[model samples]
Target: MWEVMSDPQSSLALPVTRLTRRKTLDQVTAECQSHDLKRTLTATQLTLLGVGATIGAGIYVMTGEAAADYAGPAVLVSFVIAALACLFTAFSYGELSSTLPVAGSAYSYAYVSIGEGAAWTVGWLLLLEYGISCAAVASGLSGYATSLLSDLGVHVPAALSQSTFQTVLSGANLTLTVGPRLDFVGGLAVMIVTALLVRGVQESARVNAVIVVIKVGVLFVFVGFGLQAMHAAYWHPFIPQSEGGFRYGLPGVFRAASIIFFAYVGFEAVSTAAAEARNPRRDVPIGIVLSLVICTAVYILVASVLIGIVPYRELGVADPLAIAVNAMHEPWLALLIKVGATVGLCSVLLGLLYGQTRIFFSMSRDGLIPAAFSRVHPTLRTPWIGTILLGILVAIATATMPLEVISDLVSIGTACAFGIVNFTVIWQRNTRPGITRPFSVPLGGITIGGFWIGIAPALGIAFCVIMTLPLCIDLLRALGNGNPLPAILLGIYIVIGIATYFAYGRSHSRMAQAPFDAD
Candidate 1:
């Protein structure tokens, strides 16, 4: 006999269990074993994937500007702070990915520990995180690519090379101004990566690994060459006094940390590759932790050398690293850095696009979205349709939008998803104590009110929340002063997400067909 429960909130007699349904660990593991994504990714490839994603525009482009505008020499401290926050979240991810070994990353973990609704919410946030982030990276890539071309005597018209819109803040009001330009270069870049992704995961990983080597080598060359020109006097005002708000001071360091938190966002890309990892249990955790550790080291070393070689105030340009390389009196090195950045961003695009497609693949398998997203190509064994569709949407957005204005929104979305991952660890510990965890978060916790909250996850949640504060405060300040565009856009996205869930997902969810399994 099947046991049933009532849904007091619904008139359609939908079972109450469907509203708060949790997928069993056994089910998730079984699905991973049977998934269509080819298990071709090795530990090295996965680590490089994480590196490829994490090391792009953030270090090459944002670092110098962050130091100049917000943190000064203290941006090194800012990187450490952001890395610590991601470290906690990465630890939580390591444990869960090893346990579940599923495609959706945080969304899949949420489905197993929390309810389906929360899983959908996490998936929605991930869409915002990875999708918009890909567009933003492509937009940044356009700048480097266009510059590199001009250096070679090849010129692209500004109308075909620039974004169609710009976000401006005048006094208190925020306005979006249209322009007669289109980012064809960025759009073409997105399509090229999309084509590579559709070919197969292994092929994309190989390309990404090669690009990673080139960029990492480029950065190392800068560090090695720039060290001899170090000016210790540049380090005197380590912590610049506050110039009001988060402009320059200790507050500015935290503010800079919030912005550069985007740098650490892609470390979780390792978890998203779980379904394709050859040995997901061991490899996923290794990839997640190792990539973060390496990238953080690189960020700190590069920032230290950059500040030593050049005054922080001069780093606010689009090419901070190039400026530092020029300061080394090595124009050749500057050219190399620009070329590396241009090639390097393709790997970032590859990793992010791969993550986004796989996440939707997982969601589609769960029946939350259309089944077309999960359909695997017969020859390539890749989710071709979804990959192409998402790539097109992102490319269009990259061409049309002024992504700089909404980049922090990606940071906020990532932190929210990461917080949920940490929370899932705590929740799973309490609810499914007997389940085998191939890896576990370090720093065990005591039972608090009958719920065991691991120290790592607790701090992970706290760190994510703390990192999110400065960004949220900035958004609120903009809203209070008269700019409502960002808040309005976020609200619209949430409303559409809710409407989609209730209109289609709630009724069509796979859990709706299965009996509640308390065991």
Candidate 2:
């Protein structure tokens, strides 16, 4: 065992051997069949799960910030653009999930179509996408919770509700300064969601479904009242001219689209639950596409109402929707909206935490991580260890860091993962022509000189790459402005992942021991 552990071949082999090693479809299917997670999720439940994941604190909070800082009344256009990008990527995800129908979402798809190294990289990115996303959403939830409590004549002390560094905006200039505080509310919210997740998947799904109904219903109410009260003059200069670069012009629209793209993060989480899905081939695709459609429509309507009823300049608060409701002088409705935002954020936290645990579970089972992470509760059948540990880490993050910092990191990570998934679909179609894809991406038969071209995946790749540019710019801007902490932290994470692969995962992978026989 020590010889195997210390083998020089094991250390050097990861670059060549692991990169060439691909998990066969048969092996993936066998693992899915043998996995301990119960198949209890139906198409309806899955759809709600996607909605529960997608429509969260982002819509409730970021819509205002995006509108005020970037797109103005054209925020609706930004939402449409982001939705279109997500739609393209969702189609590719639909095809892959239908074909693979395993846990780990893109990570599992990459393992089969790409290779071990690519799979590990995608898994590492997913940890950022789902785990940090939970932290960001939990922090957002804390703000809404505070507002709700304030309405009930209870106020949280500033020292217990805010971050150490406070960001203050003046005109187009932003400043960050030291103002130490601990976000106990955010930490508590994560802990509560984590406890609920460890109890079981089915129970969590049920709770998520209920939360989806409440939040969606509240959004409809907002639309109903907002349209009635909208003043056409507020939207006069729809795409307000930019005072400077990336501020309320076409550039701002695209930038806002990239920023608000975080709103669509949850649809991919649906695919992560494929192993627990009752009819993965049919239901997973339906869940992915249907949820995107539902959420996009809601987002467009909500953004329009928000800017129509309240000018875009005034919409840049933590609870934008509630603030819009409050402007109408309907105290009861404002309370209801506040409640919806809080519940909505809780559901998002739950879905992300669930996806994060499943990703770790799949990687661990493949021997890329510790086996203890893969252990499912005997009766509950959930990856309790990973779930608890991730929850603790997220709690600490939410309690310490500001929302914007965590959210920006999540956007970059999610975009990279989406780009990889889109490329994986194109690669799989080109290399494995005969593989059975239960749901093939539409418009793939435009043959040009004996070669087939898939339009959807191609568009998917373009859109994902386009959305990532703004995030990269934001990262650079942050670094240039002396806010290098998030970038440094993300770099450290990637380095650790690469180091772990070389030191342990490379030698221990099940595929390294016995390569999958495609036949």
- lDDT, candidates in the order shown: 0.90, 0.85
RMSD of each: 1.9, 3.2
Off by over 4 Å in 1: 1-19, 517-519
Best by TM-score: 1
Candidate 2 per-residue lDDT over residues 1-519, each given as its tens digit: 123336776776435655657888788989988999888999898899899999987688889999999999988888988888889889999999988889889999989887888899899899888987888888888888998899899999988887666666555345667766888898999999899989988999999999999999998988998888888999979899987867888989999998888889998889999999999999999999999999999988888888888888998887788778878888889998989989998999999888898998999999999997788888988888878888899999888866575576677788888888988887787778898888988876466666566788778778877788887887777778766766786788789889988898888998877755322
The alpha-carbon deviation from the true structure for residue 513 of candidate 2, after best TM-score superposition, in angstroms, is 1.6
Error of 1 at 304 (Å): 0.8
Specify the poorest-scoring 10-residue window by lDDT in model 1. Answer: 1-10
Best by lDDT: 1
Q: How far is candidate 2 from the true structure (C-alpha RMSD, Å)?
A: 3.2
In model 1, pairs of residues that clash are: none
TM-score versus the correct structure, for each prediction: 0.96, 0.92
How many pairs of residues in model 2 come into backbone collision? Answer: 0
> Candidate 1 lDDT, tens digit per residue, 304-332?
99999989999998888888887788888
